[model samples]
Target: GTKTISYGCVGGDFNEVLHAWEKEGGVPRSQRCLDNFKEAFEYCELGDLGFAGDAFMWRNNSHTAEKYIKERLDHVVATQGWCARFPAYRVVNGDPRHSDHRPIIIDTAGAAAVRRN
Candidate 1:
């Protein structure tokens, strides 16, 4: 499956889902949503593409640690076949600019795909 898939997943404050997994701070608890989220990914056959740059991709724009919240919300994922195309698929999470959510860049800049039939 030499297919490739790339998408910018946008959901309503998905950070809550991650926090639920961590059992930490963020939005209110919602085990139902969390469970469904896990099932959804399993159903869709999607997984973490691993990432580079700042581990934290977003911040709540708060100076106080007590109120400040940072999370890796932005990400990239693909099927096993797609990942095989670029063995070195790297995700560079750029620093936040004029927005709370930072930019996401998939870096295959040095990937040299093998020619096969």
Candidate 2:
């Protein structure tokens, strides 16, 4: 059987937040889903493409001041080999359409590497 490399993105609220809280020792509580993602990421040697400016990608449609709030649920992940080839990937944020989740665009083709002496 031909070995086909597999890579994907998966996770919800990821309630815990970012990988690095700050410069100090601050580690957020890990959820089961996040844990699974981490494991898969390591298995495939995947790297994060990073979210745009806004931290939260999803939020409650309610107009209330503090309804369900928002969180970083959306993300991009790819195999290490893939990242090496295309290291200039980015996620773009656009106005939310019919849903609470805003649109995200992932640019796979990065800038060409420049050779210097």
Candidate 3:
């Protein structure tokens, strides 16, 4: 039987808001949302399906540094069972085409993502 791989945009941020970003740019969201995502992730036994591309997946494209916002809000996650099935599986973050969120591509062509972004 083929293993299952779950992935999506997941519009909300995980854990606490990013303070490492620009000033006044990284507004923190409610901890409740973060906790919820964590609970689900653990319950499902999901792991970050590593990517090869820009560090941050979402950008506001703002000109002002203080107002600019960038974050790794999007991701592809997989379970241990799923990973065992596709040992060569990988994920690549695509350029954000006029959108705040970037596109995620699943690569199963056997070309492993060798570098950490």
Candidate 4:
């Protein structure tokens, strides 16, 4: 029998934004940095799990509007093999509470089950 390779999901605060739209009220991410991230993701065969709810996952917590900053620094990526196992997998950005960064929630039971009222 042929061997099967199992690649699991990767999730956390990378501290790097993959695109310009991911960041706001900042100096703006350099194109080189964005390309580097994209290259790495392609090389690793990883795909973003995406998210619902808030678009930004991190905030500078600044009081002034101009001094404030927000970005979707946290993310979840999975290989094709892992995604195939859970077709209905969902990723959500939870409330930050006391922290500047929001919590990442993942539900393999499908969005319907996780979004129950």
Candidate 5:
């Protein structure tokens, strides 16, 4: 099980898996794809760092609001072990690259610790 040696944060244009509906609590997610994602994560023992910033990272980029529907496709996922080592990771917002999706930066450096007297 743990013998499988895999490394690296696999990411990029996933083009799917929108959490808008989940965030809104309108309806349950489609079981098919959700199941697949879960299975993959479990197989890899990945930790969902949770999404940050605007609910929707990508949109249709159309003039009409309806056509400009947004969704969270781009993400920063890390292996269970990886997160334990670097808990300060964050998704930094960047200029849109002439596309509907906004560029994201994964800062592995954990946030600075705060001390109170």
Candidate 6:
């Protein structure tokens, strides 16, 4: 019999979106870019931890509306085995304040107690 790895998680600024809806106010992301991200994610057996708060976690901060853009480039993902250990886990998108990208917070205890904008 062989044992399998049961715990894994990946979190960071992936700089890629898995779907068209993950972005706004910019030219549509190429299909290849979306497909590539999806493929790599699935191949790694990662499950999106999901998020609570504003949908977009990053902004271009352009003064002009037309040039402004927003996207969910940051992410938190974990393997099914890892998720089982913290079923109450929650991912929160925190206020950027000064940066263009929002901070990502993962709370394994349950709903995160953080403010979002």
Q: lDDT tens string, model 1, 4-116?
A: 34532222234544434333245545778767766766556666676667766667767776776766665565566566666766676777669888788776643443232
Task: Point out the worst 10-residue segment of candidate 2 by lDDT.
Answer: 20-29
Q: How high is each candidate's TM-score?
A: 0.65, 0.60, 0.66, 0.89, 0.70, 0.87
Off by over 4 Å in 2: 1-33, 109-117
- Per-candidate Cα lDDT values, in order, are 0.59, 0.56, 0.63, 0.88, 0.60, 0.84
Q: Candidate 5: where is the Cα deviation over 4 Å? A: 1-3, 18-29, 95-97, 113-117
Give the runs in model 3 whose Cα sits over 4 Å from its true position. Answer: 1-24, 29-35, 112-117
| Best model number under lDDT | 4
lDDT of 2: 0.56
Judged by lDDT against the true structure, how good is candidate 4? 0.88
| Per-residue lDDT of model 5, residues 9-73, tens digit only | 65566655634353222244577876786677667766556655665667664676444455666
Count clashing pairs, candidate 4. Answer: 0
Colliding residue pairs in candidate 6: none
Better of 2 and 4 by TM-score: 4
Q: Model 1: how far is 38 from its true place, Å?
A: 2.6
lDDT of 2 by residue, 1-117 (tens): 454675454333343434433112223346665667667666666666675666566776656654545665666666766666656655555567798776676665433322221
lDDT of 3 by residue, 1-109 (tens): 4435454322233423322431135575556766676677766667666678885776776998878877777667777777776777767788877777777788764
Q: Every model's Cα RMSD, please?
A: 6.4, 6.5, 6.2, 3.5, 4.2, 4.4
Give the candidate order by descending lDDT.
Answer: 4, 6, 3, 5, 1, 2
Worst 10 residues of 5 by lDDT: 18-27
